[model samples]
Target: MKSQEVIFVGTRSGLRLVLDAEENIENLKRVLERRLQEAVGFYSGARVTVETRGAVVAPEWIEEVRSVLAHHGLSMDERGWDGASAGSADGGASAGREPEAPPDGAGQDQSLPGADTVLIRRSLRSGQSVSFDGNIVVMGDVNPGSEVCAAGDIVVFGALRGVAYAGANGSADARVIALRLTPTQLRIADKITRSPDDEVQAPSGPEMAYLRDGAIVIEPWTTHLGAVFGV
Candidate 1:
């Protein structure tokens, strides 16, 4: 396979593997393994989707790719099975379905066994993105057009104006917290929501967004709420 045989694009949903059309199956595996090995630890725990350059990808080939991804601790997203492209080479949105209502007080404890927490000390600019297997804590703003995704919760000490996806691995209990809660889009697990289109009042204080009654809801972050996320 050539160097351009496989392309990796990060988006609000997760990571996408855009494969070239007419790629030799064996060569495809080799390139995929090599690329994944190069970023070994960084890609673990991220949900992945595969897309071809307008070619019909066989199920067996997809499963082979899935096996390779699993070896690297990544799982495949089924949405791409129908050959729907998640994003272009630059990356964009591929929204998931809204989740059913979760039980009361779900995800309140917000603890994950053996899940590592990554701290990003710098703000994320447009066209930048970060994805992790566990939780994420960003010390600065997430500017518009940027994205932050984790399999667990996300806590931003500054503004979140871009896209933020918590529980990217299907954990509906995950929450997103920011000093300024506005965002282009917000996703928790399989559920998705966005900021209202109408003008809104300024954020009075820190805010938290989470799944409630099968929809995403935002509330003021209080002193007690800090204990829930262990901030």
Candidate 2:
């Protein structure tokens, strides 16, 4: 399977899946499965538009591709390559459902990584950087000099001593949360703040940062804060 045979492309609207129309259906299935498995749950609950580069595709072959994508928790856009709703080989129309975003005003729990969310299982070292179109969850620490930027929210299960920018896409509602929130710098949307002059100390509990009156505010994360964040 060539790398170009199964490609995942990111766009302003969302993710796109480009397939080689000339490739064997079985081969495409195998390659697509392998690629989706590599990302695992990262792309789950996401809808993707399929592109075949103007090549005509057979219904059975397309069904095979759709099955593979479904196995990985992805749905094909109803308006596919030709920008029109398409039916299945059996002449049945399959509705494409967009992934649901977190409820308005409520912060999504980091435990349940959702659509467009990237889960990093390992700690980031100095000079490391991560940029994503959606939410970012670090299972481990983000060391000093590292950087993380997300279009949505940013969550660190362990210490966060590095730089973090949430709402990179200009979403003022986005937030940043960490178990130990002593970052070199933090930014939520257009608001930015740096560590205090005081020496960095361990936090009593997890902390969260969000925009307030056009400024960034850091506070201890509490269970009842759902009123502030919705969830």
Candidate 3:
């Protein structure tokens, strides 16, 4: 089944699940397993919150659900019941602690290199703007007039003829990579560069753009270079 086939049940506030099927407990588990196998990489390391409907669910049932999810590497959290809340167990607000937001100006976690990356397996069309405060990886083409901006780096597995900005949060070390390096405008940190007005031959293989001598330069994606010097 496709990703859209998964249903998100909102029985109560703040708890939801992407369920593959809705039926008996055994059937639900089987559906979930099948879905997980279809897209294992996409769901890996993802934290999911689940909310039980108004049903008076026992702790054992919850535990069984948790076990099934955990087997597929899914983490779950429940929405606490409080006073007068419609989904509250005792018709009262949940006594659970409130959730905290990420720190202000954190933009994205640059310290944890892997945590900052986003993987998109879909093509980006015109009028689409993807802004991430960290690294971004697109396994599809970035069509013209579309924009992809990141504070860290950008890796496009397909053609890139749109606007792309890397190192948006003043990261001069950030880079922009793509299979076809043709863009309306490219920026790294504080510097900006654009394709020449004259049509140039497009490179067939992957290419990377980084800072060089206070400017942005595009280079072939090869391993011959020891280290990139000067930014």
Q: For candidate 2, which ten residues in a row score worst on lDDT?
A: 90-99
Which residue segments of model 3 deviate by more than 4 Å? Answer: 1-115, 225-231
Flag the better candidate by lDDT, 1 or 3.
1
Over 163-224, each residue of candidate 3 has an lDDT whose tens digit, in order, gives 88876645577788898889888977668888899988889788899998888989887654
Clashes of each: 0, 2, 9
- Give the per-residue lDDT of model 2 (tens digit) for 1-231: 459888775433445676776788888888889988987545555567676654557777778888888988777765554432233321111212222222111222322222579999999999998887688999999999999988688999999999998876456777899999999999876577999988866788999999989899989988778576775
Instruction: List, residue by residue over 1-231, the lDDT tens digit for candidate 1.
Output: 549888776543446677765789999899999999997445667767666654555668888889999999888867555433324222212222211211112223323511689999999999999987788999999999999988878999999999998877666778999999999999887678888899999798999998888799998999897787575
The model with the greatest TM-score is 1
Output the TM-score of candidate 3: 0.50
- Candidate models: Cα lDDT each: 0.75, 0.73, 0.62
TM-score of each: 0.56, 0.52, 0.50
